[model samples]
Target: MIYAFLNQKGGVGKTTLSIHTAAELSGRGRRVLLIDADPQGSSLAWSNYREKANFTVVGMPKATIHKEIDLLAQDYDDVVIDGPPRVTELARSIILSADIVVIPVQPSPMDVWAAAETVDLVREAQVYKPEIKCCLVINRKITNTAIGRDVRDALAELEVPVLKNDIGQRVAFAESAASGSTVLNQKLSKAAREIIKFVNELRRLK
Candidate 1:
């Protein structure tokens, strides 16, 4: 299965989630392959932080994606891609190649607009692959805030099925990214459990 973490806007924790998702699946006994389609290379650098890692994340340019996929095809059970900003052809390719596309958005108007464009991009890709599964995930949410409720309502009213699990803002997530460890490695954080549950549901969908 292939999953892409995407958002047009920056700082929505797309790469962070992508790395963690790859780690969680790898820990769960899946041979996970991660492709950092973004030129920023956050995922790739994070993957390199660990002296040894069970999963791998590679940085690949947009033009040679198909070739890279061919090389890694037989070596892994699942592929998770971290895509760049939306105004690029690379993100489209990532979406097209995914079995499931996960869009992570902040509970704010600007992020919502970014996610809207991403949703349309995914929809347009249906011409090439009509069976793709796409879903929205509200990330970096603040509980008891009106913004969180608004994001949930807006997505639901638009018929977008938001994930039942939400990613709360936590320092463990940041530390995990810097050290190439997932929240699953954080041991006792609530956010870690939410990330695990959310990714498990994503696995079930596949």
Candidate 2:
């Protein structure tokens, strides 16, 4: 299976979610390949910092990635793409190549507002690949905030399926990223549990 984590807006935690997803999938014993489709190479840098041997990490930030991923993906059981931000051509290519597109939105007014374009792109992709599955996930949500509480209501206007499992605004995620590790390293932590539940929900979509 191929899963792409994307959003037009930056700092919404797309790379963090994608990295954790790859790590969780690797923990499940699947031969995972994390494709860094973002021109910024955030995932690549994360992989370089950690140097973990659990999965393969490759950089393929081209717009023609839909054409190239097939060959490279053949060797892996699952491919997780960390897509680029604000590049429509590349975003379209990633959407076309993925079996599932997970859009991570933070519980912020700006992030909620920015999701429309990404949703529109997904709609366009579905016109071509009718079987492609997509869903929105709340990421970096601040608990007890009014905007956070109302984010779902705001996102509802976009008419996309919002996953029940969400990732909170936690320092653990940033700490893990800085060290090339993931919340999975601390299984008992809330951050790890949230990611586990999120990934499990994704599996059911298959």
Candidate 3:
């Protein structure tokens, strides 16, 4: 399976989610590969920083990713693409190649509004790849905050379904990412548990 983490807006935590999700799957003994489709090479940089990565991480910033991904997918149990933050040909190619697209939306009105463009691209891709699943996961959420609740409610008005498992604004995420480690490497952290739950939910999707 191939999963693409995408959102047109930056600072929405797409790279963080992609790296963590790939790490989680790889830690579970799945043969996972992470493709850094973003021109910024965030995922590639993270992988380079890691002394040892359980999964393969590559930088493929070309618009022809849709054509290149299939050959690469044959060797891995799962492939996760960290998409670029613009509605460009590269983003479309990533969406077209994905089996599932996870859009990370921050808990704010601006973020929600920006996500609509991504949702639109997903819908357009679905016209061809009807089996391609798309969902929104609220990233960097603040627990017990009214803005969080409001954001969740507002997402309901969007065309895509929002995942029940949302990631809170935890320091662990930043610390782990900076050190080229994942939340799963931490001993009993809430961030780790949240990521595990979200990955499980994604696996359950047909």
- In candidate 1, position 45 carries an lDDT of 82
Model 3's number of clashes is 0
How would you order the candidates by lDDT, starting with the best? 2, 3, 1
Off by over 4 Å in 3: none
Q: Is candidate 1 or candidate 2 better by TM-score?
A: 2
The alpha-carbon deviation from the true structure for residue 200 of candidate 1, after best TM-score superposition, in angstroms, is: 1.3
**Stretches of candidate 1 above 4 Å error?**
64-71
* Best candidate, TM-score: 3
CA lDDT of every candidate: 0.81, 0.92, 0.91
TM-score of each: 0.93, 0.97, 0.98
Error of 2 at 173 (Å): 0.9
- Using lDDT as the measure, which candidate wins? 2
Q: Give the TM-score of candidate 3.
A: 0.98
lDDT, candidate 2, 1-206, per-residue tens: 99999999998888999999999999999999999999899999999899567999999999998898789899999999999899999999999999999999998888888898899999999998998898899998888889887999999999888999989999999999998889899999999999999999999998
lDDT of 1 at 58: 80
RMSD of each: 1.6, 1.0, 0.9
User: Any idea what lDDT model 2 has?
Assistant: 0.92
